[model samples]
Target: MSDTISLVVAGGGTAGHISPMLAIADAVKDEIPGAEITAIGSPGGLETKLVPEAGYRLELIPKAPMPRSINLDLFKFPLRFIKAVNGAKRVLKESNAQALLGVGGYVCTPAYIAAKKLGVPIFVHEANSKAGMANKVGAKTAVAVGTTFANTGLPGEEQVGMPMRSNVAQMDRAALREEARAFFGVSDQNPLLLVTGGSSGAQSINTAVAQSLGLLADAGVNVVHITGRGKQIMDASGQLLAHERYHQVEYVDRMEYAYAAADLMICRSGAGTVCELEVAGTPSVLVPLPIGNGEQKLNARELVAAGGAVLVDDKAFTKDYIAGHVAPLLADQHKLEEMSRAAAALGRRDAAQNMARKIIAEISSRSTSGQEG
Candidate 1:
């Protein structure tokens, strides 16, 4: 065996999957500086750019979404999966991969199959409260499984929390408040509100925030609205709305700034967002996406139960709800402070290091045992 062990990380299709994948990859690199790391993702996903930009070589496989119903696509599913598995096998075999790490996505199923066939040790991280189709299958045969939430329904999962960006995991909101506020061009005196809907933006969230802007302004709250790409809020004349306290950006490269700056957030409660909110200890009024097997609601359940956050129905999250709900929350400093503290209590600041160390220990043990044999 070579001195360096080769590893492959598999996940993609969306930022939710890609972000944690990269974080885990970074952690793995830290844990084993001599380890050779490669990544596997679908061709069209965000990983195409993000993976390479992070300085790791990437291998592309075709996406193989599990078909839900009887359709022509269902007929095509088997062929697609086989091709993806073949693609994954080529990457792993050529790299002589010793282990495989996967966060759930369309690409994971094939990677899992390829790794199993090659006798590579498999580790899986499931970031949602409920396992997706890929993870539900991957976890059954994986050597070790990790989860962001308890009772994720994946077999033999250990709650190592979500592997998140170091900036988020180590964010000191109180200390970074002033700098974060300045970065968003907001006043530290006023409570800040952040509204986001991920990379593609949420139409309903954008509308509600736009309609409630005046009410929020009256309550002396400043706003930072991330309107997704090509989704900026515009006036009747189709010009981007401009207000002294209302800052609009289609995307933010440095979301830690926004998270640190805001007193509250109104956004979907994806696993990544929920984990980030806890890590940042930022109070949020969660608006779970009204689709996708109700996983978002499950994602928010623990935080809401802990009094760190609140949830609103997708349809009910309108201007009126903003006035009756959000405005009052922003006004009460004591309440906000309490919620912030509650959120902070649930944060796992060392999750990346924890998961990384586990990977290294497990892989190292395998190598040692093999050499002795």
Candidate 2:
């Protein structure tokens, strides 16, 4: 039997899911040398753009949300799911995939079902402390489940931690800090505050940060804010004055630089974001997303429990609180340095390669059985 392994990665709606999926795919390729990976995503979601941009083949599927509770839109779910599963089946067959890794979203369901129907080995990666609906359903049949958090429910789950991008994972912090400061046009004399509201920016964060721009600037904090594209409150405080102190961006193309450049980060607590911060050893004030069932908060709790981060409630995320929480940390260089060490120590830098190696082994075993029969 040939040694090449083929696998499909299904699930992606947000940067939280898509970034880790891409990282895993990259890891598989790196470890196996000739492994083939295809990602399945919704046509209009972030994955449609990001997966292709990351140089992986994306198989678009038709999918719609399954409302957790009773909703008017729930009626259309059956029809949408049928179409999506059909799309997933087609992609799996065309790609000759031996396994499917579900990353936990509505779009992941169809692919998981398709793999089950075809007798393909299914693995799942649950990035949250709480298992999403999709992963919960797939759990019964999943051969193995990997998690970023320790207690994400699955029968035979392994803690693989979260996989960061090769670029971010392999970065040299000392050198990166120098280059990142240069990228933002900030010198070592001035401390930098890097703020982001996730990939698409959170309005509450954007508004608070924007409104507190003068306070930030006045405190000698050169701001590198990722305000997200087309967000209404992006520039609410004032226009960015380049070469002075403030650097405002719609999106951050270079995350390594962002981590290296910042003295402290004020941001939302998505699993991937938290992983990146820890991996880069950047201290942050994490404001969990005030939506959903508080999964983001749970993620932050893990970091906080480890003494790696400070958690600020979303309700308490006003300018005064922002200044009170962040300013003090930035002002005390000793605290910043200690937190940085803790954050870095909490990071599992080898997680990407570990996960990639495991998935490739599973695929190889499945392929061997298929060839033998």
Candidate 3:
């Protein structure tokens, strides 16, 4: 095998897809110095910005979303998909990519097809328990498939856990607790509750937490709520009493600090969020988004099943629910500790490294076989 390998990573649109792709890219770069890593993403997707910012070159392809209903878009899908596949092939040819790693998104399907057509090895990583359409199709011809959860029902699936940022995966909440708490203006004695609804914020989670702020304050809990961009949350009560205890922000740039400050989390159950919480050993109240194909619920299942989190229905996650269920959970220190242990036990601290090694090995094996022939 040569001293370096060239790889193409495909996935984007949302942070859930992009974050893991970046994690694995970083791992591969560390494991093999002078390795060439290129990212393929749709021009309009989040990866256009995130990929470059993360210090990697990104190639653009047309966004071809799979149409579920019979419509004009569905009729036009074939041409768009072909263009995307061709764009991916051009990227592979220019980069001389030896292998393609798909993290599952719109970009992945075309990249997988292009890699297969060009006789490049393909590896797929599915972040959610419910496989995305791209990864589902890609897995059929992939050399191997890795998943964040077991029994994903994808072809040749292996449980490799979610690839997380190294800092987050290895964070020691206890060691950084004091500094993290003070960064958020939280007191040392009070239990801290961290609530977030991802980058865009969820209206349901925002409203419920905002309405229950006073109740949480009364229970002597400190709250740090990330309302995402352009989200303004007001206390539900006419008068804002004990406002100091309730801190509301649009977003948190330093999530490691937030994770360290948190004694408990109230957030939507996206795969990345679930994985990060587990890695940090933080217990949570997981309120899955009640729409789409029920992917959020599937993502939260293993954590809840492991007794690391409590699942509450979206409709029931209101002020009253918080007063009844969340309040008591916060007050119970012993139960919180037990839940933390369960979360830590379920976390895979070296997922990025594991997936990286697998990709490199597959590439090396193919290279050796080509040389032998």
Candidate 4:
């Protein structure tokens, strides 16, 4: 076993999961110059690209998603589960990882199960107000459970908040806005509306925004829409606007800039986006994703209660309704300022640092107890 302080962050299905893993890796490296992080994810998940792109080595692991239906694939679950655990064991042994950290997903099963078998410490970070199935199962064995929600159902879980990127923690509104506007080539006079539905994009949100493009332009709101690649929305209406005023992209590499360019945001209430909005101090109109046992709704609830955002039900997200709700917010400077303040107050910018400190302490304690790897 190597004495190097190494971590294996395992799990991924969305940017929400992958991004936090990267944030923690960054935090660990910042605190411990010699720390190393390796991510293990399935072949085709977003982590395949995001993990490596974020400057960390990625180990591809074969893990099958749990099928919802009673199909022949169910028979493979037992074999695949065993194979995944074996694969995780190989990674832990090869990388000399001192601890296994599960970030919450189906891909988490192997590392979590392997850690328990090898008598290695397990740490988990759940990024939702409610527990996901993977987190729920992994919680029983976690040495420490970190979470974004204060009321995480798992016993002994600490509310460590959601880990965020370095840029999010360091954002200064005055400086960021000027830089972001210039980066996007947006004019200062126009009300900038940044719209996104996470990395894969929000289809309903995009369609509604597309339908309301004319109304939005007429209201003097310049729009930057990050429409995901598959959900195409290019048309004559969005194209007719001056190219300088409107920006559409399938994905945004520098989200800090996007957050900076906007006067107000209209987007899905994923944990990452909501956390970033709070760090950036930008007001938002939240359209929670109607999936995953109402996780997004729960995330939005805290912000709405804090006066940080306005929550719109997915069913009520029509073109006219969105235009009606967004029009006045764009028109009113005073209300926007209040929302911005509330958003800033609601953010937990130190989450990544806090998680890193605790993990380091735990690993150090274990090493002192003669469990060093």
List TM-scores for all candidates, in order: 0.97, 0.92, 0.96, 0.93
lDDT, each prediction: 0.88, 0.82, 0.90, 0.83
Q: Write the residue-wise lDDT of candidate 3 on 278-328 in tens digits.
A: 888899999998998998999999899999999999999999999999989
Clashes of 1: 0
Please give, for residues 1-373, the per-residue lDDT of candidate 1 as tens digits.
3446688999998888888888988887776677788999997888999999989999998888889899999999999999999999999999888788899899999999998888888889999988888888788888889899999889999998889988888888989999998988875688899999987899999999999888888888999999999998888888888866799999988878878999998899999999999999999999999987999999999999999999999999999999999999999999999999999889887767776767777788988898899
> Taking the tens digit of each residue's C-alpha lDDT, what string does model 4 give over 1-373?
2245898888797888988888888998888877888888888888888888889888877876777888899988888888888888888889888887888887897778888888778888989888887888788988888898778697678887789888777888768787788877676667899888877888888888877877887888888988876665655775432333567778778888988888899899988888888888899999998876888898888788888899998778889886678977899999999999998987888788887777788888888778544
- Best of the candidates, lDDT: 3
User: Model 4 off-target regions past 4 Å?
Assistant: 1-3, 236-244, 371-373
Clashing pairs in 4: 2-373
Q: What is the model-wide C-alpha lDDT for candidate 2? A: 0.82
Better of 1 and 4 by lDDT: 1
Model 1 error, position 275 (Å):
0.5
**Candidate 2 lDDT tens digits, 116-225:** 99888888888888888888878779887888888877778888888778788887777788778888767766788999986688888877877777877787888887
